[model samples]
Target: MRRPGSVRTLLSCLSATSLSVGLMALGGGAALAAPDTPPAAAKPMPAQVVAPYFETWTGQSPAELAAASGNKYLTLAFLQTAVPGSCTAYWDGETGRPISKDTFGRDIAQMQARGGNAVPSFGGWSADTTGTELADSCTDVDAIAAVFKSLVTTYGITRIDLDIEGDSIDNAAGIDRRNKAIAKVERWAERTGHSVQFSYTLPTSTTGLQANGLAVLRNAVDNGARVDVVNLMTFDYYDGAPHDMAADTATAAAGLHDQLAALYPKKSSTRLWNMIGVIEMPGIDDYGPEETFTTEDAVTVGKWAAAKGINTLSFWALQRDNGGCVGTGGSDSCSGIAQDTWYFSHTFEALTAPHHPHH
Candidate 1:
């Protein structure tokens, strides 16, 4: 129940294809820098450590998010367009509206008051260069970078996630444009003396590179762009095919780890920040009668990922699966509120807890 335009703030999309390709290339090239001798085993931390993906439009107050998530790290979605000294376009829910810098500042203050981190994200699905476009034109990288700098300074945010999506990655110019944008952002960070971290959401499959998006990421890294992490969108690959949830999660995690390790050896530790979906896609029916992820299913996947040394996990949404569909009356329906609750609470517990019974 986000106010009409709330969600737009989190509507940015990132191309998954580009990220996979870049990581693959880096992983394949050189042996990562390693100490000659093996390092000692590091003890695992508690399992309650979890990162929650939040939609700007959920209309939920910052206090509500903090309460539901138990003060875990929350990634607030897309901050679409930025006007020089004016307002920025954000989605409260579905409606797009211009919001002032001060208003956004107040929102962040509220989030911080709840013991949460508020990170601004850019780019998202349906980014047809209209509502949430970062730059007026592709070549306006400097301008875009300036806007990002302004956002960080204005809101006192330290991390920024870029979620570029769509067909803008189909040509040489597109790739260059994207790369320049990344570089510009990096330059801004360096000059401003801020620890502005950058991450991108890319396609899960490496084969999806022919789309030109992957090429953009590869070129960016090749040219020395500072990308801290890559979040791989692994779901949504269903094509009317039956999928084994546990097995698919395992395979995808393993494959992504291997590929990313091989491509970007230097940044191998920054492997797939796997995107798990809790909501059912509109047209897909392969994930059983009622789609979505269950608590047991989430735990299974979390265990599998933990065993493989993949630590970062982000759900597609926090508000969408608010433990509401738990006891609606049918086998196909969700198990109960406990399921949704465990899906997150347990997943966090699993992540932060010691790894006694290894996956």
Candidate 2:
């Protein structure tokens, strides 16, 4: 389910499987060049942060909206190459929008100044299905790793979210390469004393992650990729049935907790719960009238997520937290149900407290 502004900058994604031929030299850009200026000391996100997806393609400043919506941290969405087979990634796949302080540097810094940081997310639905995703289009593991390192140096962000969906979930070769790059990045982070965490945002069935989604994480574990979080997009079930949106959110997360337990049996129940994240499709999702999340659901889930101590509680997007378009499904601008603007943000952002003491 591609977002409204997804198709504006897309190119055919040719499968370029050169495979892990060891570490390859980074392509042009600061991927290999030393930073023009020294990066300041980093301010990592809180262990429990509510970072809703911020749509970069909408020509809106994430910092401006975060301030208006009372959200400090935002997960900037969809960084990939404009063209497939290109190792170099750009925000929203825009060639002119390469990573630099001139781009989102000022805004990201402002968020950090306020005790929050922007976590850049890569590979949205359009990129995943089209093969423009960094790991899918570019087969060079080293180049992929280099780009990730640059994000840390340029923005001082502590976490990266990988929103793998559709075709990319089943890409065995891409999964292997991505996990290899993650291992490399982790090693680099350890040496440089940077706290970098990777979260995989995968689509889930009502029960749990389907087979393809599981395969992605399995490869990560096999390749020694430290998965700090497993975020599930709990919207857009598309089963064409009326749903108890809030209850379904609970069941879906519970199923994921079981899956995480199976994946890492050594971890305790609290740790497995902490490793989880859920994205609610506020208002109506892409499945028309079959799926809807209400304002009451937001309040309920916020309290539930904090009590359960889930690492993250986010929505499909920050921009869609309003009631501008009633009965709409998947509108990029507003939530399709009746509610005040920024209602969801106001409800969920409080969970960022490092210690969310339960009542």
Candidate 3:
């Protein structure tokens, strides 16, 4: 489902500030002309890098993860509630889930140890919580603002990613609701005078009416959200048989890139980050009983995205494939479908290697 190549073409078309402004307006920002000063020549695109908003789950200690990953640019905690339970703001530690506040402190400590940035991600695939509810109850605009202030004060997190997903998108009145929620968060951050980065994860493709998809992103930006990066779900494109992993990722990325380019031109500032799904969920679709992705396939997808100028590549999960799954032969083997995970790390290293252009 990840189409990096197509996204690249979309990036190419965004050469005019008016178009960029237009797309921003579509996302909900008021239009402004490109600055009158001659814009500086575009900086050479850096070699694609891994913006690992590392997903931390139950049984994994933040301290351990910091040691393992060596503290990257962004570390994210994937918080969720079991089925039939409504969303809650804090992590249910008793249930092994870390609350936002808890995760924030632990992650900050880990980042300090590992030397990378840590931020809290509110939701995941099963997260059905609404931003409005989070803002209204747990922390009002001012309190929420204060919380972030404390985060910067205590742990020095420079970014915060809002990874809300699932049916909650459909609950929105329109793009405006999503934009307003994000705007509230952004305004709070701004009021605190912190240069915090904001990002979101939408649906992989245009399948649902859920606001967590591309259409919702288009509407959110059109209304007034000031999100910095839009990370598209590039995996889970097929359900049945294992689809051609590279092809699907490229297609998803390309499609998303094109859509954004059409809507916003010349705004390369809004970078496109690709999410590659490495977890092999079988029997869910036509992809057969079970199948796993190869590391080579993951690398191919990354290479394709970079060739097209889409520099960011993130993997869906970190834990699922630690042991090989269905189509991957034996458990713990890194060959066959299991290779997909191995390739993800390898590809990231290769892409971000020193002297590599397009970082």
RMSD values for the candidates in order, in angstroms, are 12.2, 6.8, 12.9
Highest lDDT scorer: 2
- Give TM-scores for every candidate, taking all chains together and pairing residue i with residue i: 0.67, 0.89, 0.64
- Each candidate: what lDDT? 0.46, 0.79, 0.43
- Where does candidate 1 stray beyond 4 Å? 1-49, 82-101, 113-115, 128-131, 135-138, 169-175, 206-213, 266-291, 326-342, 352-359
After superposing candidate 2, which stretches have Cα over 4 Å from the reference?
Answer: 1-38, 353-357
Stretch of 10 with least lDDT, candidate 2? 9-18
- Show model 3 residue runs off by greater than 4 Å: 1-49, 52-55, 69-74, 80-88, 92-107, 129-154, 174-178, 206-212, 238-242, 266-291, 321-343, 357-359
TM-score of 2: 0.89
Q: Candidate 2's residue-wise lDDT over 139-234, tens digit each?
A: 999999999988998888889999887677778899999999999999888877787899999877777787888888888889999999999887
Writing each residue's lDDT as its tens digit, candidate 3 over 1-359 gives 23222211111112111121111111211122132211122121233445444434333454455455432544354433333322244332113332323344554454444444455554543343323223222323344444434434444555555554444445445334545656765676557454555566555653321224666667667766666655655444434445665566566666666666655665552354332211222111112223334555666765665566554555544333343554433221123243443335445545555555653
Q: Give lDDT for model 3.
A: 0.43
- Worst window of 10 by summed lDDT in candidate 1: 21-30
Best by TM-score: 2
lDDT minimum window of 10 residues, candidate 3? 21-30
Q: Candidate 2, after superposition: displacement of residue 310 in Å?
A: 0.4
Local error of candidate 2 at residue 318 (angstroms): 0.8
